[model samples]
Target chain A: MCGIVGLFLKKDDLRPQLGDMLTDMLITMTDRGPDSAGIAIYGPETEGMVKITVQSDSPETAFAHLDAALCAAIDAPVTIKVIDTHAVLTVPEASEAAAIAWLEETGLRIMGSGASMEIYKEVGLPKDVAARFGLREMGGSHGIGHTRMATESAVTTMGAHPFSTADDQCLVHNGSLSNHNQMRRTLARKGVFTRSENDTEVGAAYISSRIAEGATLGEALEGTIKDLDGFFTFVTGTRNGFGVVRDPIACKPAVMAETEDYVAFASEYRAFADLPGIEAARVWEPEPATVYFWER
Target chain B: MTTTLDMTATDLRAVNTTLQAAARAQANEDYEIINPRGAHAMACGLDGPLTVTIKGSTGYYCAGMNKEATVTVEGSAGPGVAENMMSGIVTIEGDASQYAGATGHGGLLNIKGNASSRCGISMKGIDIVVHGNIGHMSAFMAQKGNLVVLGDAGDALGDSLYEARLFVRGSVKSLGADCIEKEMRPEHLEILAKLLEQAGADAKPEEFKRYGSARKLYNFNIDHADEY
Candidate 1:
């Protein structure tokens, strides 16, 4: 089992509350999946690195190469944080075209990227992970987080989520994707690269490529329902807004509560309990094979 | 001591207050729960000779850490009820949810009605007796336990399993990997009778059948690895 959440903040005034609020939500779901935690945030006007996260078996070896290659790779200095097997770095702001290239070439296989989308992840408890990324006081209008149990792939940072596509769109998942290898083969044919064995990454890239073309988040999500097999509850973070989707069976659990201030979704209700005055917020399961999207 | 809870109140603090008050008012070794709501995680980790008689339905993980305590529910239960019970007795008067006796190390679970999937999954050493129909994967991965299903069973029963004795009286959809049907011996019948008596069951000894592991998964070999 895994816990996933995404938020679309309608009001800019609520941006400052995003990190703390999302952190609280992630903490509540710690029990569902405790292997690792990851987050991706997107803002309308920010120029951010489509960040790529990876965890090499040896952090020391990984860091030496990262530090040496920072100057040759991008135009600006690299901002990086390291702990244990996990690490995150901001690849100084780059254009959509350059960002895409930088993401694919990161020393680690490009499982996903957060650009204009601030991505954060760590290998520990939800709150501990947020603390590792200094998320407690940080603020953003839209973001997503995941706690993974690793039913399909080995529990590693490389396999953890918030997968990206087309260097812009990012996606997180709560259930298994049955048609993973088939989807990967198709994406590979289109020159889209996949880094990890995780099936969610393929789906993320699939959505990212679609949004890059012209389809809206909802259309791309609904389109994948028939193509992507197996049980899946997805939360996508996009430039315009955030959206959620579920597979036909709804075998995985997901509940969403939309308030005047924010739209929050989680695998369970306990995670979103601290959303100011939103006590037990009318939590209801999202319909199977349905997708919901909104932006403000 | 007999105490009942109101169904309207969702807050456990109010209901706990009643249970605590009843425990304080009565000095007897056995206690009774008169009216229970759809409360979850009830009577978790309780000890001593207290007997909790739930009057109505309950939610998830009731009597989770039952020690010397004995809890009897008058109605059905939600998921994970009696999960990880260490030692004691948990009796359900009606149907039980999935993982009815999941990972229970030691205890006696008596289900009078149907039981959902994974009824005795990952049981450590507990004894569970279900009087009616049971769902799929009834003993999926049970490590050590005595499971008695007096009715029909479903597919993958005892799949990828461990040392657990399963007794079913009706049709079994399918047996899991390395699992096979066993004989109902006189000694095993006596053991079943003792378990039934603990569960407050009054069924005849002849009305049961036995099923368990073939022990093929215990040893490792190139040919058998794929079967696992």
Candidate 2:
């Protein structure tokens, strides 16, 4: 089993506390999974700049002088902020492709890239992963977190959740897919390939491919219900939207709570017990095979 | 007197052990559980008379294998509430997750709100009354007991059932294989009436449609050997 938590703040007043609230919620579900933890935050967007999050096992040498190297390689301004084993590289929007290509050549794993999204994930407990990333101090408008139990893949940093295949888009899953290999082959024929052998990565790539083909977030999620064959309760985060969908035979548990301030999703209600005004929130389980989305 | 237990202060094992001891002694006490925070296995496996009221929602297996206890959840319950209960009354004021009261031998499970998939699945000698709808594949292979639903039922109600009685007041999405609607006779009406009253449901018994097994799949016959 795995645990997934997502928070989409409806009001800007709660943006500053998004990380704190999501971290607490994820920790409450630590018992559901102990293999690895991951989180994706949609923070404030800087005009003309894109953020590329990368990870390396040895950050001391991997991140050393990374800003100047990337600046020279892309022939543009670059800034790198190191946090534990991960770093967020901010560069010109036009240089995103060059920067990503240069980072890939250096053997750094690209976690995600977007104007507003920064992803941090590692092979450890949720609490430790959150602490290493200074999750409590970070601020965002919406975020998604996952604690994986490692069923379809090994317990490695690459296997952690919140798999991102597109800019400002990510997905975290709670159930395993049986037909991921088949789907992966189908996607490869269309020029969409996954980096890891993990099944959830294929799921993320599927959704991104759909969105790239001009499908809306709701449509992309509905496509999963028809195309993806397995037990799944998926929470996907885009630039300004948070979407949820469960398979028709949804055995994996999911609970959602919504207040005027925010919309929260968790594997259990225990994660929501500490939210402000939780007593007055409208809480319920999402219907199977139905797509629910909240957008600004 | 009402004894209060704060989940944040006391561990779950200690709280359950204390209640179990009181039940074994036949103390017949009343307990109030506060700040449940959706914890699993709240107030389970009692052997004597006791009244437990949980102030908030609970996680999986709340009141499982209950005996001679009246456990009430003021809020929603997670999966497998009152599972395999021997004898008792388990009540949920809010909705319940999947497989509520599954395989219970004897008990009355009352849900004021909707119950998710497989509500009362494989039930044996238990009485379940739902105030709202029940989800898909409910009462699958039910061997015995009465399941009363005041609202609609999801797909495949009472699939491959045996001897158990199903009473639905609203429309059924579809019936499962070998589970068909039977005429609501006087005895079934009486059973439904008693279960509804005990569960505090307001619907009239005459509005329900009874369903049971066609007695086709369980027994073997020489003529059906080729099909098997």
Candidate 3:
């Protein structure tokens, strides 16, 4: 079991409160999953620039000289901002691929890469993880968070959620996949690599591959009802949209709330109680085998 | 005298203690629970006659195993509302999520709005009245109870049903094994009328259809092998 949450802001005034609100919602679900926590934030983007978030077990050594090394390798100016074990590297859009290849050679794991997204996660309680990363002090337009119970994989930083396979797209899951091994093999044959053994990451990669092949987010989610096996409720965030889907049986619980200001999702309603103007929000349970996505 | 408890404190333990206290008092005690905010396990394990009103929605297992208390929710309810209840009255003013009134025993549960799948599943003794539709697999394995629905039932209604009586004013998508339509006789209408009266529903019993077990699979008869 795990807790997953996502928020897509409709009003620009609430962007600054994104992290604070999301942190409270994630913390409220601590009892659902207490092993590890992670979040993906989509902030403002600038023209001709891309950001890649990466984490390292030995941040002190791996991060040292990283900006200089990558700048020289890509022959482009690079900037790195370090926060705990995670760092966000900004580079010219044309140099994104080169920068990622260089980082991969350096042996640092790529958490996420996109024009505007950054992911941070670790093996610890959500409250502690949020505090360590100073999550509440940060601001963004849309974000998703996960607290995992480690039902299928080991409890490690790489095993945490908010898995991303493509730029500006990430997903958090609340259930297990029965056919991930087969799906992972199929994806590998097609040249899409999934970095972790967790089924959630496989699901993320599946959606990303579908989108990469030119399918809409809605179409990719609808395909899961037929292609993927096992009970699952997925909340995926792209640069401009927030999407939700559940398996046909819908064995896992999921609730969604929408207001004039934002669209929010959680494993339960308690996570939404603390949101501003929630009493007036339109609350409902997303139907099984249906995809609901909202874009700004 | 009436007491009010604001749940902004989010202290479920304290909210339940006050409910227990109100139940045992000699005088007629009334309570208003404000800002429930979808907290789980509210009004659980009550054993005394009292009136309690919750101002907002609740989470999982709200009012589970209740007895002798009249509890009401002003808004929607999450999964398993009034689950396994025994001898009480729980009223939901809005929609209920999945498994409403599951495994209930001896209670009156009224959902003014829709209830999701598996409503009144494994019911031993409960009277459930829903003004709106119910999802699939409702009343499955019910031993003894009455389910009254004003709206349509989804796929597989009354699956594996036993002893329990079902009355639906709307259509049934399908019936599970050994569960079939039965004649709405005068006695059945009379029983349904009383249930409707108790639930404050404004529907005529004669306008409904009755469903129950065919009893063919009750004793594991070998003659029904193909059907099984």
- The number of the candidate with the highest TM-score is 2
iRMS, all models: 7.3, 0.6, 0.9
lDDT value for candidate 2?
0.94
Q: Rate the local accuracy (lDDT) of all candidates.
A: 0.73, 0.94, 0.91
Worst window of 10 by summed lDDT in candidate 2 chain A: A279-288
On lDDT, the candidate that comes out on top is 2
Chain B TM-score (each prediction, in order): 0.87, 0.97, 0.95
Question: Which window of ten consecutive residues has the lowest lDDT sum in model 3 chain B?
Answer: B20-29
Put down candidate 3 lDDT per residue, B20-85, tens digits, no spaces.
877777344788899998999998877788888999889998888888888999888999999998
Error of 3 at A210 (Å): 1.7
Residue ranges of candidate 1 with Cα displaced over 4 Å: A47-115, A280-282, B1-228
Q: Candidate 1 clashing pairs?
A: A50-A114, A50-A115, A51-A114, B33-B53
Question: lDDT per residue, candidate 1, B1-228, as tens digits?
Answer: 344445454356655544445444544355555444445677776654567787766666888867666788877676688898887788988777778989999989999988866788889898999998777777888889899888889778888778889888788988989888888899889988888787777676678877788888787879765876
- In model 3, what lDDT does residue A84 have? 94
Look at candidate 2 and give me any clashing residue pairs.
none
RMSD in order of candidates? 10.6, 1.1, 1.9
Per-residue alpha-carbon lDDT of candidate 3 for residues A4-77, written as tens digits (9 for 90 to 100):
99999999999999999999999999998999999999998989999999899899998998999899999999
